[model samples]
Target: MTTITQTAPLGDRTVRRIGFGAMQLAGPGVFGPPEDPDAARAVLRRAVELGVDHIDTAQVYGPDVVNELIAEALHPYPDGLVLATKVGGARDERGEWVRASRPEQLRATVEQDLRTLRTERIGLVNLRRQVGGPEPDAVPLAEQLGALTDMRDEGKLGLIGLSTVSAGIVEAALEITPIAEVQNAYGIANRTDEPVVDLCREHGIAYVPYYPLGSAFTGGPRALAADPAIASVAAGHGVSASQIALAWLLAHYDRMLLIPGTSSVAHLEENLAVDGIGLDDEDMAALDRVAHLGAPSF
Candidate 1:
C-alpha cells in the first residue's frame, strides 16, 4: 500500500531502503572496541561498497566507542551518505544503559556525537526514550524535544527522529516539530509497534525497524526466521531465513527502511541481497502469522 520504491526519504536525502545499523560494530555488549578493529573498519567499507548509504548509530553504543570507529572508518564520508544517530541515553561504568534525556544531557550527547562522528551536522538525530519504567528519566519529553529543536535551529542537525516511543508520544511530538524518521523494536516476530509504524507512514515519516530479523543477531529472541513458516519460505526460495524475514518487511510496508547490521562480510552480503527475493501472497501470509506467536522482546 506504500508508493515507496527501491529508495526512501530519510533526513535530507532518499537513500537505499536496505541500510546498515552500527551497533554490532562495537565490542560484545556494545560496551567497548570490537575484537578486530581492522575487520570492523572493513565491514563499514564493505557496507558502503554494497550500496548502503544510510547508517543508524548512537552515542550510547559502546559509550562513544562505536562512533569513534565510524569516524575512523568513514570520515570524509562519501557524497550522499546519511549518518543518523541517537541521543537520550548514556552508558555507565558497568556498561548498563541509563537515561540521559534531561535537556542539558541531551544537548551534551549531541555535542559528543558531533565531535565523535567528525561531522558538523548529523543527517538525523533520534531521541531514544524508554517508554517503560527503567529509563524515561523523570523529564517531560517536550522539554527534551525542545533542546533538540534548539540544535536544529542552530544547524547542528538536519532532522529529528524518535525511537522506542509510543504512537501517543509521536502524536504529541508532531505538535512541536516534524519527525523525520522512527527506529522501533519491531520485526516479523514482534509487530508491537504497528500503530507507530502506520502513523509514520500516514505522515510520510520513515519508520526504521531495528530488529528486522529478530534479536538473533543482537541476542534478544529466537531468530524470526526460525519460525517454521518463515523457514519453509526461505527453504523454498533457496535463500536464508533472514532473507525471508527482511523481504516480508519490505513487501508489507512502503516506507519501512531496514538497518540490518552485521560484523561479518558474508552476513552483510546476505542482508544486502534481500531485495532480490520475491514473496507471493502465500509467502506473505505465512510470515504474518509469526507476529502473534509469543515473540520475545529486548
Candidate 2:
C-alpha cells in the first residue's frame, strides 16, 4: 500500500493520523491471549509496513498480551512511530475492567507499559478517567495527572493525554499539564463528545476518536452499517459503509485522528484506506443528518 499523504500533529511529531488500535489483538472481551498469537503479530507488522505509525494500545489489553505482540513485531520501532497507551484500569481474573487510577497505580501502570513495550520511555501516555459509567475508583484530577506529569519529568512519558473525559475535564487537565491529545468515544453516530472535540480542534490538540466506526453507539455497528445515508454516500464513493463512516470523520475535522482497531490485515488495510474516499458538501450534509437518526447524545 502507498503511504497516505494526510498527516496530523501528534506531540512534537506529525503522524499519518489514520493509526491502528491494538485492542482487538487481544482475546475475547479484551482479556487473555488471543487464540492466534502469530496472526496478531503479523497484523501488527503489516500495519507498520502499510504506513501506520501511531499505534494505540494499553497495558490492560490482554492484561499484557498486545503490548508484547507489538514489541515482538516492531520493538526496534521505526522512526516517526508513536506508541500511545492508557493508564487507569486493569482486568481481574474474570476479565472485568477494574478502575485503578490512584497515583501509585498510575506509576505502576506506566512502569509496566514501559517494560512490556520494551521502551524506556513511551511516546504518549493517556490518563484515562473512570467517568461516563459507574466506577468505584475515581481519583481526583490532581492525583491522576500529577503522577503522569511526574513520570514525564522523570522521562518515562513523552506526552500526556486524556481519555473518556468531558470538555470541562479537558479544560481542567490543561491547567495540570500540556495535553497533547484527547481520546474519547466519538463518531458520526455519537456526538456526546462533540464539545470536547471542538475544544481540542480550537486548541490544535489531536482528537483521537477510539470507536470511530460507531460500534458501541445506541444501535450498535449494524445501525450505522445499515443506514441509508451512509450506504448512499458509500455507493457514490464506491466504498463500504464503514469507509463512509471513517471518511466522514476525516472530512468532519482536520484534527480528527482515527484509531479503528481490527485483527484481520485485510480489515486493517480497508480501514487505513479511508483517506482516499473524499466526502463533498452534499455527502457531508447527508451524513450530518445521520446523527438525528436515533444517534445517542451520550
Candidate 3:
C-alpha cells in the first residue's frame, strides 16, 4: 500500500518527494502566459489534491507568469506545502535565459517572487547558477550566495539551495551557507551528476533533479523512449516507459526527488503514478545497467 506520497525533510519543512515542477506551465520557450491559463490552474490544484506538497519554480519561468497562476490557483498554500523558487536568471524579450545574479537583481527577483506568489516569505529560495547556456556567464558565486544569506538573515527565505552547479560549487557554497537542496539534470541515461548526487546524499541534502525525463539537451523523454530495456521493464510493471523512468530515479537513490514538468492533467497523473510501480531487485539490476546501455550521445 506504499505510495510515492512519502514525505521527507526539506530543511525546516517536510514535503512529498514527488513534487510538481511548474516550469512547463509557462508558455513555449518558457516565456509569456500559458496558452491555457485555466488548465495551468487546474494542474496546480490537482497536484495538491493528489498529495503533492513540494512545488519548484523560478522567476524566469514565464518571467513571472507561472507564479501568478500558482497564486491564483492555490494561494494561501495548504499547510506542509513547500514552495521552492529560484533566482539568478531572467528572460529577455525573445524569451531566452540571461544571467541576472547580481546582488541587486537577486534581491529584486526574490521580492518579485514574493509579490507574484502573494506570500509574505518564501519557503525555499535556490540560487540557480548561470553556467550552462551556449555562452555561460561568469557569475560570481560568493556575491550571489551572500545576497541570499543576507535575505535569509532578514527572514525573507526559510532555506537555501543551488541549481545547475557542480560538486566544487556545492562545497564552496557550503562554506558560506547551508544548502538544503541541489537541483540538477539527472536521470537513468544521464549519469553525469552521479558524483554530485553522492555528495549531497552523504550530507543529507535533497537532490532534486530538474529534468528526470531529460532536458532539451538530453532529447526530452526520447532518451528513454528508444531504450528497449526501459520499455521492457515498463511492460512487465504495467506502466509506461516514463513511469519506469521516474521509478528508476526514485530507486536509484533515497535522497533523489523528482520534479517532472507537464501541462496536461492526464500526464501529471501518469507521472505521479510512479509511486505504484515498485521496481524489484531484478528490475533495479536491469535499470542499473542503463547507464551502460549505449547511453544517449547527448
Candidate 4:
C-alpha cells in the first residue's frame, strides 16, 4: 500500500502530521494492560496499514503499558515511522499518575522507554510538564531541557518536544534548547492552547494537539457527537463528525499535527480518513462558529 502524504519535518526527522496516540491501547482506568491484547495488537497493525507513519505514546500512559504493547505489536518497526514518547511522569503503587522530573528520574525513564520500545534512541521525547497544581520546585525547566539537550547531542534522542506547556515555558525552553514539537490540548470545544498553536506556527515547529475531539468539556463525547452544527456539516460531506473535527484542525493551522488515540481498528481507519476530508468555506465558518460558542481561555 502507498503511504499517505501527511508527514511534516521535526528537525531532521519527518513524521506523519496525522499520527496515532497510543494512550487508548491501555486497559480500563488507563493504568494497566489492555483488556483485549489481541484487539489492541490489531488496532496498531491496522494503523500502520492505513498509512499512519507517526505513533505517540508516553511512559505515564500505563506508566509503560502502551509502550510495551507498541513494542510487542510492532517489533522490528517499519522504516520511516516515527515513534514519539514522553517522560517526567510515572504511576504510583495504586496506579495513580505522579510527576517526577528529577534529573535522575528523567534519565531513568528515558532509558526504560528505550528498552521497552526496543530501540537505541527515541525519535521524539516530549518533556511532559506537570499540570493541575502549584508550580514545581524540583529541577528548573532549563535544567530539565538541558538534560534532554545533552541527550540529543549524545545521539540518544533524535528530537525533543514539550507537552501541555505554555508560551512562557516554550520561551524558556527555546532559550536553553531547541524544541521540535509542542503537544497541547486543543479542539473545537477547547481553545485553551490556541495561542500555543500560533506560537508553534510562528516558530515553524510542529503543534500536536491531544484530545482533538473535545475531551474534558462539560458536554463530553456524547455532546460533541450530537452537536447539531457538527452533524449538519458532516452530513453535507458524507463524513463522520469526528472527521469534520479533525479536518477543521488540519485546515486551522499548517503546522498543526493530530494524534487522536483509539483502541479499535475501525476507529483507526475512520480517523485516518480525516486526511482526505476537505472543508469548504461555508463548512469552515460553521465549524468556527461552533468551536467558539463556549471557547475557553488560552
* TM-score per candidate, chains pooled: 0.94, 0.93, 0.93, 0.92
Using TM-score as the yardstick, the better of models 2 and 3 is 2
What value does the lDDT take at residue 223 in candidate 1?
53
The CA-based lDDT of model 2 is what?
0.85
Candidate 4's TM-score: 0.92
Clash pairs, model 4 backbone: none
Candidate 2 lDDT score at position 43: 95
lDDT string for model 4 (191-215, tens) is 7678898898888998888877765
Model 1: lDDT equals 0.84
Error of 3 at 147 (Å): 0.7
Ranking by TM-score: 1, 2, 3, 4
Summarize candidate 1's per-residue lDDT along 1-298 as a digit string, tens digits. Answer: 2232688888567999999998988888888889998999999999998899999999988888888988999899999889999988888899877778889998999999999999999889999887324444478879989999999999999889998888988999999998988888888777888899889978999999987767644453345555788779889999988887788788878778999878888989998998888788877777777745433343
**What tens digits encode model 2's per-residue C-alpha lDDT throughout 187-268?**
8877777899889988899999877776443445667778888888888888888888888788877878889888899889
lDDT of each prediction vs. the true structure?
0.84, 0.85, 0.84, 0.80
Ten residues in a row with the worst lDDT in model 2?
A: 289-298
Residue range 1-298, candidate 3, lDDT tens digits: 1234366678767777799999899887788999999999999999999998999988888889999999999988998788899988888888767788899999999999999999988999998885327454466788888899899999898999998888998998999889999988788877888999999988999899877887644456776877878878888988888889899888777767788888889989999888767788888777766643222231
lDDT of 1 at 108: 97
Off by over 4 Å in 4: 1-5, 131-138, 216-220, 291-298
